[model samples]
Target chain A: MVLIYIDHSEKEIKKSSHEAISYGAAIAKQLGCSAEALLLGTVNDDLTTLGKLGASKVHQLNNESLNNFDAKVHASLIATTASNLNAEVIVFAHNINGKAIAPSVAVKLDAGIVTGACSLPSLQNGFEVTKTVFSGKAFASIKIETPKKVIAINQNSFGIQNYDSSATIEEMNLPIPTASVKVTNVNKIIGEIPLTEANLVVSGGRGLKGPENWGILLDLAKALGAATACSRPVSDSDWRPHHEHVGQTGIQIAPNLYIAIGISGAIQHLAGVNRSKTIVVINKDPEAPFFKAADYGVVGDAFEVVPAFTAAILKMKHNE
Target chain B: MNILVCISKTPDTTAKIAFTEGNTKFDENGVQWIINPYDEWYSLVRAIEIKEKDPTTNIHLITVGGPEAEPIIRKALALGGDEAIRVNSNSNDSYVIAQQIAAIAKQGAYDLIMTGKETIDYNSACIGSMLSAILDLPYVSLANHLEVNGNTATIQREIEGGEETNEVILPMIISCQKGMAEQRIPNMRGIMAARTKPLKVVDPVATNAHTSIKEFSLPPAKTGVKLIAPDQMEELVKLLKEEAKVI
Candidate 1:
């Protein structure tokens, strides 16, 4: 059996979870085994629909304590589930929650683990998986010699491919671990598209001058129906919130389109958005490093260029 | 309060990455090594910040590497660590490295053990989480704010599009990131004191590494930038619509 852990937030299933299920199911098909999904906490989305996306069965642990992410607790829960199902492979999306718990689970199960996996394992001769390393500057293919394995799929790597099947939901009464970390408060951005899930992202840096001039970036984002982010320096300087920061140490996103405005592309910054399918850079300095990574480069001041770009996008949308 | 901070010696952020010896090893000919930025700026700094609040608090540093890593360990000591320990193993396996750390952390009975989210070189982001499980301690990752009061630690960790604050007891392990603490530059006093600080060498615990690196390959380089004239906003929009279709 192949088990995929489905992660959710605020009762809603995250987009990455869907991608993981698809990736896991593809692996299951290759190994000629059944793919199943495991959910720790209660989620609002239809578990049956998740089957159509990937898994043949959905096992949910309807425990409230499992809602708040404690790596220790999650790892323990996942390790138990994998064992009970006699799972040969376990999969997780390499998001915040996955990154925190996958290693722990791997240790508990004595499984050979690969995080940030970009492709499915080659089961022809042996289990060989490719993963991103060196902060996305390189790729390393690893062969899992262990009998059981765990893989954390990177976002946007394997997309969701639908299957014409409905999953049977099963409730498991398992012993949930005691939570040591108590969530005191949750400060969440209510409505906008999350940076992790957004297909297109509009990010800025200190090059925009100050926080007061952020309206142009927002306008472009709104016009394009994209999420917004900022470079680490922008967040460090209090020009934007830390949640908006994306870099080697910040949120790693692999959107289809990433628009960087006024951001000089440092290698660390590139690590975060380098996986983006299409990068568009807008900066005044012709020698800015970001352009080298961008698919499209606009060499002009962000102040003059961003507004004009936003206007043209709005015009195109209006015409559409 | 006794805090144990784990740091890694990595190539400087701007160092050119190259492979050597049949692409099996990293070329270190001209690379300048430094303490991983996240370790220096966040993990070690936050522990030092806790120590600064109470003089009784002691901060110790540890890294799993050889003599070449001693200088990086000294850098952490100069930043506010009381002592340093270098595990005598240059293992690239995160699991083996975590075992070494868990062994030291277990013996020390540290109230808090912290490390960066991941090392820049390997970028495994696994040591702290694996160590937490091995030590049977509560663990938090990507912590932006951490404040310890008595036996409880209030930590605010970064979440998707927001933040979540959690309170965990002492003897917890954390993988820290930015916003935890400001960068502290080592002053002359720190540099002088760090040289005389107790630097201990310890043997690594015997454990099998689950993973081994095979080879190194760089990402495909960008071909060429398609520069669009700044004034031609219409042309740019048309290109995006027709060619890129991103908008």
Candidate 2:
């Protein structure tokens, strides 16, 4: 059987988890097996809805301690669950939590593991998988030779499909281990869409001059209902928060539409946002390297172009 | 008061990526290698900061690679480590690398193990977690802020949409990233001192790589961009809506 690990935060399921379930279900179909889901901790979301994404059954471990993430504890329980269920393949979303836990589980199960996988495995060629390497600059095809394999799919890399079925939720009681780590505080960004889950992102850079000039960029982001981000320099200079920084050393996002303004795209910055489905670069300099990587380019000062662009969008919305 | 910092040598961040041997291997021609930035700027420096505060804390550097990794380890030592160790083997497999480090770490009996969040080349952020699993130690990853007090370490890590603060006991593994510490350059005195530091090279233990790279390929090049006039905002809006269908 193929088992998918469902990741959630604050009682809500992450969008990337749906993609993992869909990917796992397709893999199970390829291997002629059943697809199931392993969800740790309690969530307010309905479990039956997971079947629509692909899982045939959902297993829930309802221990309250499981709500807080402890990589060691999570790995041990996940390894046990996979072993008891005779799962030949395991899948997870290569997000923050998955990146921290998947390898430990793989070590426990003695399974071949692939992280940041962007493509489904090809069984015809002995379970070959493709993943982005060199910071999304290139791709590498890897073959997992172990009998038990673990794969973590990259966010936004796979499509989620809806099916006309509901999954049976089975509540399982498992012994919880003592958590070695204690989470004392959590500071969440409220009222704004997270960059990882945002479909559209508007990012600014040093060319915007300083923190005071971010109003135009924020205005556009607000008008479009998109998330806001900044280049590394912008964040380093304190014009934006560190969490809003999107680059190789910061957060890497692959939104559907990414708008870069006043930012001369450096290779490090491009490594993070190059995977966007559609890229639009706006800069006063016509020779910026970002233009080469963008799908659309506009050579103009962001101060003038952004407000005009936002107005045009508002006008279109008013007409619609 | 012992800390083991793991570092790796990787091609400079700005180096152009290319494959050789029919895309089966990375082409190293004309490539300049440096200690991975995350390792040098964050993990290593953070360890040094802790040592500066406690003076008795010992910082040891470790790398798993061939002899070519020696220079990188020496440079890391100059930053503030007491000694260095290089496992005499090189592999792209994370499992093999983690196993070798775990073997040495078990013998060293260090109180804390540290590594960068991930290498820029392969970007596999698993070594710390895997090592923790192998040694049955606690693991904290992507820690941006760390404060060590006695046997407890308070760490702040980035989550999907928030920052989470956790406290873990000593004898744990952590992967560090930006905001942990400022990058420190090796001065002339530190460089002269690093020459006399002890660097031990040990043979790797027997292990099998679970996965093998079959081929490499570059991402498809972007098509030529459609340049829109700055004044034609309405037209750009139409293109995004009707042509790109992204708005």
Candidate 3:
């Protein structure tokens, strides 16, 4: 059996979790096993809706304590659930929660685990999975020697498919462990699209000069219904909050449309946003490294180009 | 205060990535190695910061690699680590590395353990969390700031839209990131002093690697960019809407 961990935050199921389900389902099809899902806490999303994403069965741990993410508890409980099902493969979205918990789960089950996996396992002779490495500069195929395997699929790597199968939700009665660290607060920046969930992202860098000049980027983001992000240097210089930074050492995001405005793509910066489906780089310097990775490039001053781009998007939205 | 810092040796950011032997092994012939940026800039620096605040604090650097990784570890020591430990092994498997780290950390009884959020090489990001599990200690990943007072530690980590401040008791693990501390360059004095720092090389306790490499390949090189003039912004929007379907 293939077990997928359904990621959730604040009562809503995450978008990347659905992509993981599809990836797991495809793997299950290859391995001739059943694809199932395990969800912690109760989510507002209808459990049966998971069938569209290819989950045949959904096992939910409905305890209130499981609502808030505690990696230790989540890993232990998820490992137990996977063991209970005798799952040959456990899949997770290589997002915040999955990256935290998957390794612990792997250690518990003594399973060979792969994170940032970009493809399905080749099961002809043995279980070999391909994963991104060297900060997305390369890919390596790794064989899982262990019978059980855990895979954390990178977001946007696998497209979700509608399988048209009904999924039955079952409640599990596993003992929940006490959280190790207490969460003093969960402070969310209200009324902004979250970078993780945003399919469209508009990010800026130091080239914007100062925080005072952020209006153009925000306007572009607002016009596009996209989340805003910044390069690590901008965050380091306090031009943007640390949470807004997206890079190798920051929040790794894989939005569908990543509009990088005035941001020269450092390797660390590219590592985070390289997974996006379509990258749009607008920088004054034509030699900026980001243009090479972008599907579309516009070399111009942000002061001139941003307003025009934002106005164009607003006009298009108005036409719709 | 005893703090253990974990380090990883990775190819420099500008190193040319290549594969060899029908893609079975990485072509390391021309690659230049350095301390993984996050380890140097965040993990080790943060440990140094804590040690500077309280002069009695001891910061030890540890790396799970062969002798080739010693230079990186020594570099870390020069940056402010009191000493260094090199576990004699070269396994890319994260679980095996974590087991070794857990065993060593248990024996040391360090008050805090730190490592980069993820190495720039494999980017598995599971070692620190796995170490926390094996040792049954609390862990904070991608932490921007950390403060310790006696047995209590207050950590601030980035969440989806904002940050969360968590309070945990000591003997915890933190996978450090950018904001933990600024990167420090080793001064001439420190570099000279590092030659005298203790670097104990030890054999790893027997561990099994659960994964093996089948092959390696570089990602397809990026195609040249499609340039669009600033006046053509409307065309770009049209393309995104009708062609890319992302607008």
Largest DockQ belongs to which candidate? 2
Task: Give lDDT per model, in order.
Answer: 0.89, 0.93, 0.89
Q: What is the lDDT of residue B150 in candidate 2?
A: 90
Tens digits of per-residue lDDT, candidate 2, A147-243, equal 9999999999897988899999998878887898999999889998989888899999998999999999999999889999999999999999988
Tens-digit lDDT string for candidate 3 (B1-247): 9999999999987777787889887789989999999899998998998988999999988899999998899898889999988999998899889987887898797999999989998889989878877887878788889999999999988676777888888888888887788878999888999999999998998989999988888877667677889889999999888877886
TM-score per candidate? 0.97, 0.99, 0.96
CAPRI-style docking class of model 1 based on DockQ = medium
DockQ of each candidate relative to the true complex: 0.71, 0.82, 0.72
TM-score for candidate 2: 0.99
- State the TM-score of candidate 2 restricted to chain B: 0.98
* lDDT per residue (tens digit) for residues A1-320 in model 3: 99999998888888889999999999999988899999999888999989989999999998877887777788889999998999999999988778888988998898989999999889876999999998887899989999999999988888889897889999999888878778898888899987887899999998999999999999998888899999988998899887788987777788889999889999879988887888999999999989989989999999999999999998888888
Candidate ranking under TM-score, highest first, comes to: 2, 1, 3
Off by over 4 Å in 1: none
Better TM-score candidate (1, 2): 2
